[model samples]
Target: MTTTAPTATAHRSGRRFETARQVADAVLFEGYVLYPYRASAAKNRMRWQFGVLVPPAWAPAQGEHSLQRTEVLMEPRGAATLSLELRFLHAQRRTVQEAHADGTFTDTPALHLPDRVLVPWDEGTEERVELRVAVPELTEKEIVLPFNRPAREDTEPVLDDHGRTVGRLVRRTEEAEGVVRLHAEELEGPYRVLKLTAVVENTSPWTPDGPGTAREEALPRSLVAAHLLLGLTPGSFLSMTDPPEWARSAVAGCANLHTWPVLAGEDGRADVVLSSPIILEDHPAIAPESAGAMYDATEIDEILALRTAALTDEEKREARGTDPRAAAVVDLAETLPPEVLERLHGAVRSLRAGTGAAAAPQEPAPEALFTPDTPWWDPAGSAPAQPTPDRVLVDGTPVGPGSRVTLRPGLRRTDAQDLFLQGRTARVEEVLHDVDGGVHLAVTVEGDPGADIRREQGRFLYFQPDEVTATEEP
Candidate 1:
């Protein structure tokens, strides 16, 4: 008989998070809420903008609904249990004091204030929540879970540099929980597709006032910014759609890979904060939009441009003393000094010169090494790798610089290495040679969903000759 270890401890190799700091860094992404943590940011005038459920009558009219459904791929080896920890932000509208342009500060004379989303927890309310899952082979089922109000007694108030009270700091709270059990007999084989639905009804007793009242804003009866965390029994894994861009390489490596939507740093390091109770044996599949390459700006060149674009000349100089990160980026941008605008104009001039024409390559270094080893400290006694010529033929098809090819299925150099989607075509931009004289092709796959240092630098994906099939002209 197989004994099951505790869900959290079963995967000793997995990542853990003790705080929701990392979780919030990921959850509060892309329009979840506006800055200043208030409801006033121009981008956040509309609350409950994402991952929210409004009242049935009000939802349909607002192009929304009370329920959300998403599917997950599960691999079950035996009787197992699936658990979920749900979290969300609960806010209340309250009266506030505002300072006018004319230098007068006064109470708005109303119970509710404009552009304010306050955290008001009764500290004793319990919420009843329902979670359900269904598969083609089984009937729809539900589990009821009671969610407690977040504990806020110890919440510290926030202050600015001038000792002014800005607001209070509120951590993400567990609004509800549920667990679903699966039996081996219920499984068709090793894999099953489960459609999971989490449902929550507005049970808060506080009613929102509308226009004409002292608090003249029409608010939802209950507003929440919802999120979910899934825990699977040991030996089972789950996958979801819309993986984060950084996790695409892992997901593409296997034909039968299981994935879950989890946030990860660009360095591919999983969050170690232990924010959730469940430990997944494999890295969770990320949502496509999470930590996008453009938004994160991991490359030095990209970082420099993004950070310096908005700075005033004075601000740029002050950044050197005030912000080390911004200062470093600005410094790097100064070093590039490339004529990008001229390069664009040159391209247009060359286009008229001839079709399918391109600029000449830069000259090689002045001192070419025999074994491709520079005087820059080659390890003692290590054999130098051989170098390849500028071009080569692959699989009876000519695949050199400027050629196109498709990646073969199941070709992986490492677990996290980008796998060109099977049969997807890419351009062979460069042919590189290693010290051992090994030939490697650097190609950029078209529409690849993966993100890596190479993509950040606009570099090519390197693959062995055996991994690609040279394609003829379009």
Candidate 2:
């Protein structure tokens, strides 16, 4: 099978592909670096904590894998075609070398200059391998595509104001080899359903220097943040998470190893699929309010920007010298205008009228409660409907404040603390409605010594209406 280098021109041809690309970029740098953005940060030392495909030779010892397999069901029209883009990062070791007067350079961890400082760090360079094949071809025989990127070294001379070379930065990249195997099997059913399987493996040859070899040593030869983006013409892929009733059994039979396949692009579009290392729902999207990539996928952009802006001068200087991306992050946080920063404070995607007992009562105007200078974030300005008198329907039972109930945490509990609260009896303190119109029950555990204190402090454990059953009063 023939593979081609990915080009922007080719990607721009398809509007659906472009949408998928945006989400893919976010996944590529999900954990490229962490907060503090300095090379010396302890958390930053252990980098590439995502879908890393290491060499087969060292994978067993490191307890990591060398391959990722994604399987999805697709319904293709006559002579449909599939395009695959495999994207990943290649680790590059950057060494700082100070120039000596004798026409030689000596390696240094850091080189301090008049205006700036340079530090040795590992950086990532993006790599993409693209291929296209016909659906009929995949069904006939499995296609194996092998790709190799040769190793190389590059140097950048750091010059002083006098045009003399003060120091130089040398970046060395190790060779990487990988293979992609694609095959399809037609499933038995009334409708023509095809199960497509794509496997990516790291075939780079590597040898450990010693038994004590570390993960960092193996990363250079590994495929960091490896993932696949699939686009189809005249075909739609099924959602594994919530497949149709008819295809549920078939979806469950497919094996996806170390990767999750989710529909990409528009909310209802199925022409594209993103097989990621991180679990996501169908039609995943990047929030529009996001400033840019912050490398920490689980963090709030506003909080990270605030923390980055709050770094001391010394810390910021160190972060700026770490990597070009880190320097950009520091500049973005510091130079962001107050108005733009305010936009990152909060965002509500959708709002609708509440339902059942969770319906909110109209409140008086803000002017009646607070002065014109009241801050937007002030509680009084956007106070929630009084929760004490509010009520929510639990299994058609009206549960309100002072109501007794038995706690039953949902199967998908967000907090681990809920495990201890399971099956416990509690008294409903309030019934609350969130910005999204979802109802929650704030309750205090029964017979707790600190229940009165918690009530005074307004601290209570919250549960969804479905997570509790109304009980008769004692």
Candidate 3:
């Protein structure tokens, strides 16, 4: 949906919105290029890995999707207004052309020049659409807003020191179209809760050439890294990942397809929500120590910087010519100071007593955990240097090695596989403690065929004390 102007509420929220934008920017370009940022790199060949909204005509054939739907709960104090900002990337083709002697330009995959090398690659251009609507209006009927971008082409002539036109760079963009549909429904709960549903669909009319059309061929007409930022005034949004006790039933009824919504912006502020294709917890923020975008979000900045710095001169030149952003990454790594590199090595966000551990008399500063004599990597260097205990207390019972317990993986910290282990009986193999003084019980499934083999190999599933209940031996 497109709004010609920003509403007053949007103006007031500019500061808070900037915080969300920083994180959204990271998601937008994630995997745009990988380490060793060269166009010829194998990993770089396959692009647009996240939140790709392809044209409807090609989605079914390609086994991809063309739409994202998000349902979130919001509590409005009075007449609440909602503002949405949809952001995505439009893939643009950049072709390197060499100027012929006879006043003609021919396309070439790579054009070599004395100063720098030019290579053909696909680049992304940012697209944003904003919409504002009153809560009452959405309850009446669904609102559909259509947006379109027309095809575009641009060329820049490459020059020589003698002021002669040597070659040219041509950039072309395909047309794209989409629609945003929004509506709201009131819940039956005692609180004034409204379930907001938003849908983003790719309405581009482009069709595939044939059944064999590859993903790269269809990406030109697709929306790359599409996501939404929702803002509410005089209202607050409930967390879908962790809802309040009263709204648990209503939250369970909400259906979110291909998109996960979580609280955004500053911590403890529920006025904004970020709907993303990648699953994330509430109030996600970009690491402060990061120098710039490396396009590989899962990789650490220190490792990427060191690897980028180790690239050969010729490789660096090619990477710089691949794309403008890639060039910035090369420059950042080459010029990064030692102190900044050290900062990227690590940062502790929080420290608390582990489950079933005694409360400390006083919380220790983060710096206190490190010392000149003992390195941070050494497990025994930190406070509570004793080895792991042979047993741990579960419901006031000393469940030591060989104790039997029923797994009850908590929803907050367990994965899908852990859910399947719920209520299964297991034998405690050992008790371990982490640097933070948290307790973990290693156990092997009772009936698994490989249980004996796993014990010999020292591999077992671990659970916190609170996630398991002691059971009497048969």
Q: On residues 1-474, what C-alpha lDDT tens digit does candidate 2 reach at each position? A: 534233211342257578888888888999798888899999898889889999998988778999999999999998898888899999999999999999899999888766457899999999997778888888887888888888999999999889999899999999999999998999997789999999999998888887789988889899999999998888899988988899999999999999999998876679899999988878788877677778865578999999999999888888888888888888899888897788787654323222324335442221122223444344554657654449878889888999999999988897888888888899999888875778888999998999999999999988889899989887
Q: What is the TM-score of each candidate against the true structure?
A: 0.37, 0.77, 0.76
**Local error of candidate 3 at residue 351 (angstroms):** 1.5
Q: Report each candidate's C-alpha RMSD, comma-separated, in the order given.
A: 17.2, 8.1, 8.9
* Candidate 2 or 1, higher lDDT: 2
- Model 3: runs farther than 4 Å from truth? 1-13, 352-474
Per-residue lDDT of 44 in model 2: 91
Q: Which candidate's TM-score is highest?
A: 2
Off by over 4 Å in 1: 1-24, 33-41, 76-79, 98-141, 148-185, 190-223, 238-474
Pick out the ten consecutive residues of candidate 2 with the lowest summed lDDT: 363-372
lDDT of each: 0.40, 0.85, 0.86
Ranking 1 against 2 by TM-score, winner? 2
lDDT of 2 at 114: 60
> Distance from true position, residue 58, model 3, in Å?
0.4
TM-score, candidate number 1:
0.37
